[model samples]
Target chain A: MTQLREPLSLISECGLPAALEVMGERWSFLILRAAFNGFVHFEDFSSELGIARNILSNRLARLVDHGVLARERCEHDKRKVEYRMTDKGRELLPAILALRDWGLRHSDSAAPNLVLVDARDGKPIAPITIRAHDDRVLEWGDLAWAEPGDVATAPAEACAEEA
Target chain B: MTQLREPLSLISECGLPAALEVMGERWSFLILRAAFNGFVHFEDFSSELGIARNILSNRLARLVDHGVLARERCEHDKRKVEYRMTDKGRELLPAILALRDWGLRHSDSAAPNLVLVDARDGKPIAPITIRAHDDRVLEWGDLAWAEPGDVATAPAEACAEEA
Candidate 1:
């Protein structure tokens, strides 16, 4: 977790930009997403994400380096390697799901439907929805200008005070 | 919307970094989230988000200039300006929700919980979650494999890949 910084440059959260700056790249989330998808081996991640071997190697190293994922050699295949999420990486699932849901809503969909739920259990662990102050679900433009609830604690300078 | 590129780099859909690049930034999502949370004035945004005047001014100008938000002189206060989400801006609700959802998950009551619901009646929109094919909620490491999934089509390679 990142430490909250004192308000600087008009933005209350200093960690916001750093979070965005580090996370704002393109492939990091998907790679993390795939991790949740259960492709633990180097070859499997490559096959599932369809990332280049070179790129996979780089991202894997970065994730491990960042302590988001842990790496170990595959026992079955001595030459093979396996990766798993650290608490830090596990924490990213919410963000990943949020992005998937957003993509499904704003853009065209591919059948895989980023989420896979238990048909039998009818339960999902990662369907992270945003709700209202009273605990009701919330949406865009729902705020009435009187109360800006559930606003993202990110950089406000780039965005307007619409919240 | 960005075109689906070959999985040349990590920023492809499978990666959270990619989503961050597209949606996560200093002010971009904050502007949207604030709108969703009910903020509407330049000063209010400056005050609440604590954004620097220059940066806030720039973000407001860009969003308005890009038609994401419309700047209408306050109906009553000519000196006052009200920023409203354009339909296009409204369309960004999902993305904003997505990131907010992400934040709620990684937080520990240090942050408030979030959800999406109806504005008129305050009904739940459903909590957000993410998972993998087995209907199992995925942890980031579950998919960390050496084999990059189908990233052959990515337009560019991830920087870390080169490093």
Candidate 2:
């Protein structure tokens, strides 16, 4: 963890750079948001997001190419195509929610007119969080990078020594 | 909630568009990641991220202008400067970590060489999750949008009726 404090050239080793490479742009994320909100048809995405045809087309194609979305023939209308979210795309929910929550809390826009609520109870959902395996909340200082092979050989003692 | 299923202009009403306006680009996020990894000096960011000096300067200035980072003179060396994370920047940890976790899991790259561990127990942290206020793990289907003013007038019956 702290080892990264030095210029070790390990930045590329993390998955972040790769993830950003795929969905780092604004419209891409907005398109993903639309997908999560149940947008599938090209026209739906274009009209609802109010995104330009070329931009929406590019982002959707990129998402499908990357496997985040799958292109499928609409069962109800074989002549029509739909962009469906793959499992990989669905799994990005937490990340999207985290950013949405951050934006809701910190943006200069007028207070959000809507809130994400739990369907069962109707209460607004709690903010997205990083929790330990045992369900304890964690802070930035509570994190460290495990040494190589340490996770397999001695997970418990890995960050202990550093701490 | 499900009302978004129709063509509504509410997409811009969510905080997501605002958030994307601020930090939706790849380099901005990468720079933030480097800062979280304890990089303070411009040279450290440029050398470690292999970012161009002009690009680094531009990103740093934008982050500062947005109040995500504060530029300060290094106390120990007046001529030297440090870019420190503001509270706003620190709050993005969950979003960043969530994206990092997604990348680690879905990217076509090789398995991650390092794991993020909890400093207290040295165990890998759990995946970021969306939890209900009552601590229940929630799926995407469990979420709905609260009607405007419903959060204040009838929080419990809002999504319940929709459900």
Candidate 3:
């Protein structure tokens, strides 16, 4: 693995902090999950999440402000509003799924009441994985950081040799 | 797509809530990131993160209690302690990477100062993806939930037909 000579410097510039600012809290994530489940109306989020009206309102507004969810008027009824996931919001699916999967494996609580399946085969979805550019499955030891210029010179066989 | 006839019912039992209970805070995640970067000593986390001593102590204990990290006495210097990621903590890599990637794209901040690379070839890592059991890449529309028994009866060609 490539050593981080100054880990602090790298950590400061990392995007995780910003992502956490928008999504670190519990309610926000629960709301996003509800949105993924196709709940659009304010009432749907409020009732389903058991979130207080004020807190739900705050989270929805924050999501909208951050471009994670879009706020728009209902097409048929101008007075009715809907909260929908934007492209950016949709991109978070992997992160959400990873967390959900981790929880399922690690949580000592009740067994999962539902499973995420492939609609085509109705089979459970495969666990999320980290893959190399060549589609090789990668474990933690397989990852490293390097200077941009170093990438081009490194050989594809390097991994094989390391293994 | 399989409709969530009762979305709330599923959300109520999701593992996400439990996962969030352990990892839903900003500092905990930052600490975990530091761990991934190879920082193990208490001072390493403290000085690198500039976190308050008391807060850091609390978060570390919580992580230890949840089994996300293991606290051990330093082998070389038994008087000193080190906090290391356990297998469960290592499993969170995908989730952390996903968030970091999302932030890099969405955060209105400075360009990333570092990049995650494949040690073998030194190339940048690929984006995290949701893949089918057969290794087909899946998008949000491609996903659905169904009863466990329905999985075996569903045709492999079902996805092709829907597409």
| Each prediction's RMSD to truth | 12.0, 7.3, 7.5
Candidate 3 chain A, poorest ten consecutive residues by summed lDDT: A1-10
Residue A119, candidate 3: alpha-carbon lDDT: 69
- Over 4 Å off, model 3: A1-8, A109-111, A153-163, B1-8, B109-111, B153-163
Worst 10 residues of 2 chain A by lDDT: A1-10
Whole-model lDDT values for every prediction: 0.53, 0.77, 0.78
User: What local lDDT does model 2 show for residue A53?
Assistant: 96
* Candidate with more favorable, higher TM-score: 2 or 3: 3
Residue B70 miss distance in model 1 (angstroms):
5.4
Q: Candidate 3 at residue A131, lDDT?
A: 73
DockQ of each: 0.13, 0.42, 0.41
Mind giving the per-residue lDDT tens digits that candidate 1 earns over B1-163?
3433435433234434333434544566666556645689988887766668998888788777656788999878899999988875665554454444444444443533233335554443433334332223344334322223332222232222211
Q: Which stretches of candidate 1 lie over 4 Å from their true place?
A: A1-15, A46-58, A109-115, A119-128, A132-134, A140-163, B1-84, B87-163
RMSD of 3: 7.5
- Residue lDDT tens for model 2, B59-157: 899889888999999989897889989989988999999898888778677767778878888877777888876656788788888865675344453
RMSD of 1: 12.0
TM-scores vs. true structure, each candidate: 0.52, 0.84, 0.85
Name the top TM-score candidate.
3
Query: Candidate 2: which stretches are off by over 4 Å?
Result: A1-8, A151-163, B1-8, B151-163
* Native-to-model Cα distance after best TM-score fit, residue B136 in candidate 3, in Å: 1.7
